[model samples]
Target: MTTTGTTSKQREQATRKTGSQSGQPIVAGVRSDLHTMLLPMFAEQNEIHDLETVIDGCRIRIRSHDAGVRIPTFMDQKIMMLLAAHIRDVIQSGGQPTRHINIDRREVIDLIGGGGSTGGSDYRRVTERLQRLHSTKITAETAISADVSRRRHFSWIDAFEEDILHTDKGKEVIGLKISLSVDAFRWITQGDGFDMTRERFKSITSAQSSCSRIYAICLANLIYAKGEDVYIQIEDLRLRVPSADTLKGFKKRPLSKAIELISASPDMSRYLSVSLVRKTEDGFIPLDGRAPLESVYIRVCKGPDALPSINKLLPLSETGGDTRSLSAAESLVELLTDRGSSAFTDTEMADMS
Candidate 1:
């Protein structure tokens, strides 16, 4: 029937969920049927478009709404690949992933929590070291103006009356300004996208060093996805993360709930901002944080899919078997689900130590 909230073009921007019959995949949406049937009994249950041959083998039905999921732009996806590659490299080198690092900036700031008590001493020292390694400073400014340019024109004024005639006015909606933040991390460099973080660490001697190494690597990636620039204010700085913690085995609470509990404490929330973002077929892009317009400094984008029913998010392999192909949705899900926790959180620092 009728869909609301999006223009025709915007609605059309929504992606198709059905597959073509290539005879290779088990998921029907990826394949096309030799004989096509067009009628009522087409799509899978609770979906708007079946996007496949009405068959029993492989199938997918995508819900059609006036608006569908919006994805990260090309540059962001490139950036995501950079982040993912760096993360994978670190983990492969025997380092703990970012998820495994448990110190918030505050505990990091005050030097208290190392995510738990078991490894507290190790976490405390290592985190302090990492803090010194990746320190950076940033400043951003937003400008406004009332002038029009060659590519822009002022609109004609209408409905002027003698009783209320006055001078017509025009204004600039947004002006370009610069945000100055150091390069704490680089996603793409010199025709290659991987292994740009070697300089951020001091030589990791063991698993402990590796854990801290990966933690810094994770934060470097996390900082970029939030639309913030990562940089090293102090050169030769290193981020230290302890290799051990007792809470590593605990089942995770809902990510949103964790962010809430963290942010609910005014002091704790001040450590970092949290949000849930989506991973696309190409790469992971962060969702924005929830903050008032005037008060936030550094924003941390955290959590998994901002969308519901991630299980249904398109996978590189619609059949849930193999993923040799590229499906943007599938790509994203794999990235965010890598550690099971879907969010990335960081802080607006007073200054990196």
Candidate 2:
């Protein structure tokens, strides 16, 4: 039986505020054994036809259905099928999976092809604006405007410099992912490895240091087809884009933590906000079906409330201890909001930097 649960308690504990007073209910807390409800669906689904094999300790079950697998109808079949698919997954793609990464600055480089140009962007102009803002020569608006104009230069590059700007012209949609130690220099110098034991894969390198990772990602998104053949470099760093847009008709292996399975008929997933978590039987449900999932994930987005005691933080809370709830940090933000000109201008950021 496969089981999954929240590894952290940080998800719950919400604090909400109505109007004048902020409520303290604590933010959402990730319940332990969140996998309890999830594992059974995988293990005992009734109609699981292919049960001959097992992999990674999970029983293998594979079957085809005319319509979607109904949870109550083919419970066993679903479980066993999902298990077999899971095994096939391990065998086919290798073991386990890397969930999330620390999103280090180097990961940014890795996205753009570490040892190559960051993007086809004119970093020269961006840098010049930064220098100007730093010396108080121009306003932040001027710098950001310059940056935006420079950004405007980005478009689908024609077949001209396709060979040279291959890495810089688009966002490198990742298909494989791995974690690296938190050293940008070493990670950049020697490059991040796929398999540290045998050094199975070498990281990509970038041609320049000043290139922006965003540009590379945008470019890579356009150019590369799929797989490790498309490599990128930031400086000396190299790595494969480990993400890919989920393919069509691909039945995402049902997750043990999946509490709900919303179909593709008219996906309402995209219409929702990130703060709206799909309360499912599975902890993390897959948005795999004919139509793309456009669901908003809430519940999980606790930090957006920030420290503000009003709308965001308050809504999550029921009742509050006003003294403890009051935030000096949020107070500063509230002051800024009251002042109206809230956004940090590019010039201001550059000057501060």
Over 4 Å off in model 1, which ranges?
1-192, 197-207, 210-214, 227-244, 248-353
Report the lDDT tens digits of candidate 2 across residue range 297-316. Answer: 21211112121111111121
Q: Which candidate is the best by lDDT?
A: 1
The worst-scoring run of ten residues by lDDT in candidate 2 lies at 154-163
Q: How many residue pairs clash in each candidate?
A: 32, 96
Clashes of 1: 32
Write model 1 residue lDDT over 90-208, tens digit each, in one string.
44566643311111222222221223443435534433333222221111111123552111111101111111111223221111111111121111111112232221111221123
Name the top TM-score candidate.
Answer: 1
